[model samples]
Target chain A: MKKTLNAYSEQMNQLMGKAICLPHGPFSELHEAMRYSLNAGGKRIRPVLMQLCYEAVGGKEEIESFLMAIEMIHTYSLIHDDLPAMDDDDLRRGKPTNHMVFGEATAILAGDALLTEAFQIMLSDALRHGGLERIRAAHILSEASGMGGMIGGQILDMASENKTIDLATLDCIQLHKTGALIAAATKMGAVLGGGGSKEIAALEAYGKYIGKVFQIVDDILDAISTAEELGKPVHSDEKNEKNTYLSFYSIEESYAIAKALTDKALKLLEQIPGDTSLLAEIAETLIKRKN
Target chain B: MKKTLNAYSEQMNQLMGKAICLPHGPFSELHEAMRYSLNAGGKRIRPVLMQLCYEAVGGKEEIESFLMAIEMIHTYSLIHDDLPAMDDDDLRRGKPTNHMVFGEATAILAGDALLTEAFQIMLSDALRHGGLERIRAAHILSEASGMGGMIGGQILDMASENKTIDLATLDCIQLHKTGALIAAATKMGAVLGGGGSKEIAALEAYGKYIGKVFQIVDDILDAISTAEELGKPVHSDEKNEKNTYLSFYSIEESYAIAKALTDKALKLLEQIPGDTSLLAEIAETLIKRKN
Candidate 1:
């Protein structure tokens, strides 16, 4: 499982690097900024999950472009989230954030460009394939990233800032913010792979459970880990006075909840009737992940 | 021609208002900001151009969604451009800019949401229709608005701030910045209307000329008009030391250049075997318009 994840991550890294290599022009600075943030090191979890799910469902088509598109969306969200007007973070991945390295205006444009480019890649792929599947995949991806999904989550999180909130509100925020895209990763993979509605729904449910586990573990790590280990500021949720699972439960309790969610996710994988061993391993690993 | 244009504009206004009606939620503020900018009055030139071109090619499908999508993209660009770190304007269309009214963070998310929702609307339309034309239209829209088009132009514009750039460079900036989306309007309309490549090419060319005419007129108005007349600050280009048509030619000369471009665009419309009279009149009016 580790080797498989590394291979997917490396492949995504290479594909993403090639995706934005335009000739040097008047907007080369914008491209540079986009590339800088895009290549900033992370686990490549989303794209890897997308690929893993694709394979698990017996997909054989080349989905490199879609993988790159999803990562671009994720990277763009981070770029804008780190803007002076947003999180105002100076560091990400243990280095200066996009706005810190590139001026704010360029950073903003870079984010816009990445988002636009994601659609461009997907639509271009749809044009070549001449099918409804690509369009359906795009629709799912867009809704996941758009107002009702990731951005909606962001707004709810911001609106809840400096105020204590219940576990239900936190669940809503995390589900929209992080769960939408994570579920989208698996759902898109299933759709593109021509999975039936039943299989797609099961994987989607699995993705939801794992998404919750991911977020809860994230909250736990933020409360307990060092900045060096995480490559971003520690205690950021606390600093922002944001509500998290930690706000409602102890660290041990959070871990236990994450473990339970992982088990639920793994159980869903068992019902999928495919080679979901890797997915099962991934969910288990996610609960125990240190970073 | 004026009546027809107004008809298209009014229809677009009604459709756009309906397009973004989200049920109130924790992120209702985001929706409000998006709707505020979407409803902030403009001529709806891009959508109108699209619909005109669509009819010019004898298209009879329901394209209200596509029209709304284009306007959404345009409004998102405006919202971001007016941010404190970008153009930093306080007013737009006679009201406070998005950030001024909604605050910066929500403003940024609003811009992000608008762009995402544009895709959401377009892709949803494609899913219902299930054809390559909608995908093709979406590809064109994304490309025109992406790094190589509008955003590219913006970066160049910002990079050239306070610098005495050459006329060619100014043309490049405007072509990417303003001309790309304008051209995309006609091209997408032609594509969606099932026009052949030759017809699409011709309308695209016409769009390019009118796009230039629009920018030249904008520069002329910025140089000569009042803040009240334009509903925004005047002489902003001069204040920012940005190059424009007025930088290289007197007002009369700029008008002459714009008139020539309009004539060229009209000639292209004449070559098209359709009811291009409205497009011709639009080009002519564009060159002569005040605020």
Candidate 2:
């Protein structure tokens, strides 16, 4: 599992490095800012999940562009979420956020550039490949990132700030906020790999369960971890008065919930005929991850 | 010409009103904020250019989605440009900016939503239509709005603020910032309308010249028109210390330059073997408009 994860991560790093090469132009600073956040290390979970799902469904073609596009979307969301007008965090991954290093205006443009470039990359790929599946993948990605998905989740999260919300509402927020992209990753991978509808639906369901687990674990980490350990400010959810799993249950209870969700995700993986051992390992690792 | 322009404008308004209809969700406010700026009366110039070029190139399909998508991109740019960290303007089109009414966080999300939704609309269309031409058109739009184009131009514009830049640098900024999208409109229209490469190239040249003329006229209007006449703050270029045509030339010289560019654009139209009378009239009207 570790070997596969490492291989996928290395490939993503290489592809992303080439994806955003700085052009010899006046606006190279925008590219630099975009690279700054993108190169800042995260777990590479989304792209890895996408690759694993693609391979699990017996995908043979290279999907470097789609992998890079999903990560770009994730990175752009973080940059904007860290802006002064939003979470206003100065640190991400134990380093200065994009806005902190590049200033607000450049950071904003960097975020916009990343999002626009994601579509540009996808559309260009579609033009080259000339397939409905690629276009469908791009459409799924856009829907996940747009109003009906991440953006909508963000709005709900922002509105819910400074107040406690019920479990159903919290579920709605996390489902769209975090689950949409995760689900998109698996679903796109399945489509791009030419999986049957049943396999795609199963993986999508698997993704949703794990997305909930991921966020619950995040809330738990925020409550218990130190700033240095988490690579970001601790107790941020509390700082923003956000509702989390911790808002409704104790740490142990939250852990149990995550475990149950992971079990559910793993069960869905079993229904797939392809090799899903890597996906199962990912589900286990996500629940036990400290950061 | 006037009759055609009004017809396009009315169609655009109706389509745009339907394009962003409020979704029944917790985040309907995001939709409202998007609709606010989108419905705020700009000249609907981008979509009109797209449609005129579409007709001129003998397009016959319902391109309502692309028209709405282009306008959504334009509106999103405006919302972000008016942010406190950017131009910080309180007024746009004689109404309070998105941030002023919806607050900065929502305004930012609204901008992100519009940009994402633009692609969503386009990708959805591509899915339904299943053609390489639509995909090519979408790629053009994305490139125009991405780093090498509009956003890149924005970074140049921002860097040039509070400084005296040369005319060459100013031209680069305006060309990317404004001309890219305008050029994309005509080029995309030609492609979607099934025009040959020769016709597409000709309309693209036409669009680029008009884009330059459009920006020069904008600078002149900012220098001469009142807030009431322009429906937004005037002399804002001076306030921002940004370079414009007036920075290097007097009003008469700027007007002459715009007129010369308009003539060049009109000549480009004449080369295309299609109905270009409306395009020619648009070029002539652009150079003489008050707002």
Candidate 3:
């Protein structure tokens, strides 16, 4: 499973590299800035999960565009999140952030362009494929990552900074800021894979649970992992004065919650009538992830 | 035609007010920032033009979502464009800019939310309407407003700042920065209205011409009008060291080009078999406007 995950991550990197590369466009500078951050390596977890979900649901047709599109959206979010006006981070993925390399204006434009480009990729690919499924998938992805989902979550997180907020409010922030897009990626894969209502619902449930697990684990990693291992700053939540699972619960309690959510996600996957071993293994790896 | 334009503008205002008013969302601050600029009151030209194109092509179904969606995208651009990172303006439509009112972080989130919300509205509406047309329209708008269109143009415009750029670069800036979205608005109207390929092509051409005319007049107005009259600061082009028609040609020559483009837009409208007088009148008014 680990070997397969690595292979999938490698494939996604190559695909995203090609998708974002525009060598001779008039706005090549903007494209360069976009590529600079996108190529800054992460686990490619979102796209890999999406592809794994699709494959688990018996999908065989090409989903490279969807894979690339979701990664673009994730990359854009990271770029914007690192802006001086947002998280104000200097480094991301162990490199100078987009603004650090390209300047603020170019970084902003790059983020904006990448967000818009995601829709363009989805739409053009859907049109080429000639189906309503891609459109549905696109719409689902947009809603999940849009105002009510990721952006909403981000706003909540920002507003809660340096303030004592309740667990409910903290839950809202976690659910939105990171959870929504992760759920969208998983659900979108199921939808595109032509899963019925039952399968779709199960996958969505799986996504939601794992999303929680992912965030909780992230908070734990931030608390324990070194910057060298994390490839980004450590204790960012503390520096940002952010409320995380670590803020409200002990390390053991946080790990328990992550474990429970992973169990929930795996159980949901079990209800789906498909080979979900990769999905299950991924969930296990997520909770056990060191960085 | 003036009365009709006023009526459409009013209708758009009402629709936009409702669309942007998310009374109890978790991200109400972001929503407020979005509404701060959205309700700041422009001529509602894009939505009005979309409606006119729809009506001109004999479209009768409710297009409130598309109308509101385009306006949201336009408003988001305005919000981001006014950010400290971008134009750093204090005023828009004679009031404080979104960032000025909501702070930089909220304003940025607001802009990002609005962009995503545009897609949400279109997709949800399309699904409810049970047609591929809305999805198609959404695609066109995204393409026009995305990398190779508005954002691309913005990048070129930004990169050209504090530098001596030629007429070709200037043209690229104008065509992309403003033209693509305008063209999208016009073409989207025809598309949603069920206009055939010929009508769609003609409307797209009309949008391109009017978009050029509109930007040229904007430059002229920026050069000649006051902040009070224009409801925003004048000489911004000069302040930013950005090129425009006035940068390369005499005011008279610039006016000639705007007039020529407006005339061209009207001619294209004439080629389409519909009541296009409103569109023609709007073009004339845009070129001759004092503000």
Predicted structure with the largest DockQ when compared to the true one: 2
lDDT of 2 at A45: 81
Q: Which tens-of-lDDT digit does each residue in B110-130 have in candidate 3?
A: 888888888878877877786
Per residue, candidate 2 scores C-alpha lDDT tens digits across A41-114 of: 77788888888889889899988889999999999999999999999999999999999999999999999999
Task: List model 1 lDDT by residue over B113-173, tens digit each.
Answer: 9999999999999999887888889899999999999999999999999988999999999
Taken over the whole model, the C-alpha lDDT of each candidate is 0.91, 0.92, 0.87
- Each candidate's fnat, in order? 0.96, 0.94, 0.73
Candidate 1 C-alpha lDDT tens digits along A221-274: 999999999889999988888899988999888888888888889888876766
Docking class of 2: high
- Which stretches in model 3 have alpha-carbon errors above 4 Å? A1-3, B1-3
Off by over 4 Å in 2: B1-3
Considering summed lDDT, which 10 consecutive residues are worst modelled in model 3 chain B? B1-10
RMSD of each: 1.3, 1.3, 1.6
Please report how far candidate 3 places residue B280 from its true position, in Å: 0.8
> What is the two-chain DockQ of model 1?
0.92
The window of 10 residues in a row where model 1 chain B has the poorest summed lDDT is: B1-10
TM-score for candidate 1, please give it.
Answer: 0.98
How do all models score by TM-score? Answer: 0.98, 0.98, 0.97
Over A156-235, each residue of candidate 3 has an lDDT whose tens digit, in order, gives 89988999999899989989889888888888999899888888888888888888998998899998999998888898
